[model samples]
Target: MSKSVRLGRGVATAGILGMLVSVAVGAAQADEVVKIGEVAPITGPASYLGKDTENGARLAVEEINQKGLVIGGQNVKLELETEDDAGDPRQATQVAQKLVDDKVAAIVGHMNSGTTLPASKIYSDAGIVQISPSATNPAYTQQGFKTAYRVVATDAQQGPSLADYATRTLKVRKVAIVDDATAYGQGLANEFEKKAKADGIVVLSHDATNDKATDFRAILTRIKGEQPDAIMYGGLDATGGPFAKQAKQLGMQQKILAGDGLCADDLSKLAGDAADDVICSIAGAPLEKKGKGEVFTEHYKARFGGNPVLNSPFAYDAVYVIVEAMKRAGSTAPDKILAAMPATDYQGVLGETQFDSKGDLKHGVISLYKYVGGKQTLLDVVKQ
Candidate 1:
């Protein structure tokens, strides 16, 4: 062929190649964006709780995106939509509805049980899958909401375990209970009181307080007179820290027992020297003690510049669970994610996490811990 003809053919081939590259770039830009919602107390007193949980979810989203995941032959990008509930039930419902309206594929939040329980109905009604990272009230899972699930053990298991430890191990004959009047606080206190009484221990008094109360002097003073062997507090770390501080100031030498809410490093900051008096129970095994937990802890600290407060690891796992479901269903539709949730047997930072028919962790773990040298230290792990 002549030089002119060969040059013309080469130019045509180059033009076709450039056109194909532009089409590929257009397809890449059109990648589906999957939004995962997170509802927690990102403001108010429990903002730390919400922030910690959000960090985990954010981290998971980042890690997943880094891998450039593809679902059903379509390139996908995961996006996080976080809402602050201020740890309030009414606010949680509003946030839940907003997320539903935003059309999120799944949600991981409403950190407190009180918030989670009421907000759960909103998610359920809208058919959005919700996996709470904290919220341990047994009623949450027992309500028979197919869309509701939690990654932690419930108060039913945590309460009985704590009661057994007090009666059998601590040998406490008398106990005083104080709850913050929230669903989480009241439920935990009630369950502990029942189990303690059933174990043949004498109950001293059951006191109630609001979660926002700063001065617990009156209730503390009244309970001081009772001289109970141990005082069990049913509330989050925000209140729990101050409660322990006041108890110590009152010269109440009795040990303090509480739930997972008080198991964070900040508890020591809030309680100061009084943190050592606290013995708290978490809904799952101590993350540091788990096989993969230490690695997660290191990664979290490196990314967030601090240790995880409460259920951050679970929150991270919750995000993974949603993604796993998405992968299994080969779609990001809400109904498809819900359908794939029941068969979730995810091996995460916490180990093999399987859900039961009620959307509760099948092999739930309730780990007990105490503050040693102003740091939370794991004492025991109970499988329920």
Candidate 2:
């Protein structure tokens, strides 16, 4: 071959090899794995709720992966690391530490307010974004942790909504209050008490109970004596269910008021016919009322083989919110995602989600529900 032709062919060969190497490097960069942590009470009394939360997050991750995700010009695959906190604060902190150690990009939960509060400190210290799907205690955001955020309305809004419904709709003149003594139950009860009093509904009595207690006869007996027009129980459906059933057995004819914890699909099974007399409030719009609520429910049922319980939709929305933050930040780093969170305006299964300075939802909605024919029926949706 001629010397000039030989030199040109060699240069061309080197250029092709360089191009191949660049493509390989780009392929490696595109196959990035992003880990997300999910902590919930997956084992103990609140297993049903925790499992539902996991399902919602898992579904979101699956959909994202299937549809493909590209963040910062890099293809990202999501992996969910789920841990069971058992609805305990101590365990929740431990789970938070583990996720931090594992270097997850963000976290989706620590379901209950009790657990979420303790876990929030760990995430804040680690500079990771922690989004709680169901925790409603106003203190969760009030702690001034930029890392903390929630999709639902706070007890500050929920309690007042329930109080308004009771005063105007139920005409509850005198109402007795009870709490499970956990942060969630106590915080909600306290907010309700404050609002109920402001609305001129006389507060008859307030009592404390533990979440594990299956029987509330002692408190029920004391409450019955007070003859309050209504009874407000601030706790989960697990305890609230039996509490309502026992109140009926004790011949207490007053309607029972409760917060989101007591509002669940299985309350009818837990309280039987007594479920009919229970009125409750959820800290967000009814799922059916959201823009994408029905479609999300259908997709959820198709994937999970049943309807979503309380907060599952919220959990699902949390995942999308986190992913949207990642897209906006163009990075999966926790700090970047946290930085992008405050300005989030993603619309998901829930309506538009935006956070205030305190990481609380800017436009929160509280929905009231009642039971009829052993089914939870929506009464009203109040914007707060």
Candidate 3:
């Protein structure tokens, strides 16, 4: 019971503490890092849309990291691997292979249907989970691949709903249709054409143009001769905006109908004042009223310096869903992520997100929007 005995006890306690600290540091260093791949048109005309989606995913990653997520008893850090698909199917497949080679845990992109559909096969074969934020083609989900999924409604619902709105609500009898000649454009336009015909609406004309064509004057001039009550354009804002602008130049007063691709805030800037005459259908609930709308909007603007496009919320949700699946599976392997996808019921910035058996959202909501006074406004939300 002297000073020597007390000092020996204190030294022993200090040594134990140092060993524990070293062990803790080693565990932290062993934390697993998972990479999530995002393939979108980060360049070219659709770059804005791609950047919007990428921002959503990037924000989600940052928030998750800040929250100090622990999965499978290990601290996890998520990294984003963004690749530009240029809105091309071939480029999408190339990036898909590259992501597989890079051994990403999952993917949250391939923005357009044309790109998403083709690239999906590569992910499927590689056992990588591919969740499209904006691809709306029903065929993308109908491919029977377990690795494929989407956060938005399909053109199957969006096209018919828009057609019904045109015929019953707007009381339009004659309709003209135009597409951008890509899978997404043609598919949505075809669906609208069929539904419009079945709803007793006369289809005055159907035409085709590429997605990059800035000159829609020729097509608008031809449609002007038809004198249609409404014109449905199955393409993205890049092309749809110019089409609307030219339609205005030709003095066509008919209301413009478009699919989710054209449902963006920048449509007003792209189409100028002609955006007021455009009514577009998006494949999800309005962002401002869903899950964490206002907060997400403020955060997204602060992070990306732009308004949310049609698919940003969906992409945000897609990232959360992937991480949730990773938590459930207790691993970041591609096969495990794909296996956990079918059971996803994630509450995200968008809303309750649950996938059906075919990897499609169960309660897919379609909303109609129109630009009024140079601002995009929601008209209706249709659940399908």
Candidate 4:
């Protein structure tokens, strides 16, 4: 009732308001951060592919931040916590655990098939959704984990296409097959051998190699002795590079063919003149589409100071795919986002991308690429 009593009440109310403001500030900061996991090879032999894929995830986050985020009427910025897997399956598992511990809503990476398959299981167990940009092993999606997804075509699709091209287009009757013995290499080699033989092409010699091995002179001698018209190699850019150079020196006339893993900027540089005429097929068309692909390529060239690698567009598409799924779901919750992913049909640098129930992108096409002048060029899109 008195002036002092009224003044005392005012101070108490102001203190209460300040406390509420402090709590609100803490909550606002919490809502402002959204973590996205990115695991890839920042170092090691597979760094080229992993770093390129990492760039896509990074670019998406940057674009999403610049444009502003709108999720459930709350503004948020995507935060990327990138981990280096070193292209090792064991390291991939460790990275997956680290991302789960960090509480990232989604993951992108562990580029190699060997790493992606093993790491995906850990992510699935942790309820984290991961979309691999370049892992093409058919078993990846076949694992029945709804949280796992990929932007690139699987080896099942690419293998038959590569084999058909080798038989029908290249007109090769006798072929030698070599696989790196990893999930991707073995699966692709098996498919190509089966299909090539069915197409009346002889599987003259079949050989296996370890990914870590640098010496292949014995294998090259064996392949040369077979006198095959063509060589179908199932391996990464690292070994493929050396094989190309060695095969050329061995006086082999067989044209070398390989899958997406063999396509890399560093691979061409390693093989030098030996990389010429190596008919390597890539997972996505890096130069076919103009808008997004060109922007990515320009940025990549500026950053890396050379032409963009084959999987660059696919990596870019992987980001677009995940972002579109999140937009459609209106939530970054892993289950909801993965469910909504099947409905996302976005036109990206890799073309129209739509996922099936098995977490595999339907309507996907693998393009045949050729290395000319030490530059990988998209030759044709094998639509099936």
Candidate 4 achieves a global lDDT of 0.80
Per-residue CA lDDT of candidate 1, range 1-384, in tens? 999999999999999999999766744764798899998898988888889999999988888887777777778888899999998888888889999999999999879999999999989998889999999998998888999999989999998899999998899999999999999989999999999999998998998998998898899999999989999999988898999999999998889999988878768789999999999899997787777888888888899899887778989999999999988999889999999999999999878889999999999999999888898788899998
TM-score of each candidate? 0.91, 0.92, 0.91, 0.88
List per-prediction Cα lDDT, in the order shown.
0.90, 0.93, 0.89, 0.80
lDDT of 4 at 97: 96
The sequence of per-residue lDDT tens digits that candidate 2 reaches over residues 213-248 is: 998999999999999999999999899999999999
Q: What is the per-residue lDDT of model 3 for residues 263-306, given as tens digits with 9 covering 90 to 100?
A: 88878888999999999998988888765888899988898887
Better of 1 and 3 by lDDT: 1
Query: What's the true lDDT of residue 42 in model 2?
Result: 85
3 or 4, which is superior by TM-score? 3
CA RMSD of all predictions: 8.3, 10.2, 8.6, 9.7
lDDT by residue (179-242, candidate 4, tens digit) is: 9998888888998888998899989888999788788899989888888889999998788888
89 in model 4: Cα distance from truth in Å? 0.8
TM-score of 3: 0.91
Runs in model 1 deviating more than 4 A are 1-30
Task: By lDDT, rank the candidates, best first.
Answer: 2, 1, 3, 4
Instruction: Tell me the lDDT of candidate 3.
Output: 0.89
Clashing pairs in 4: none
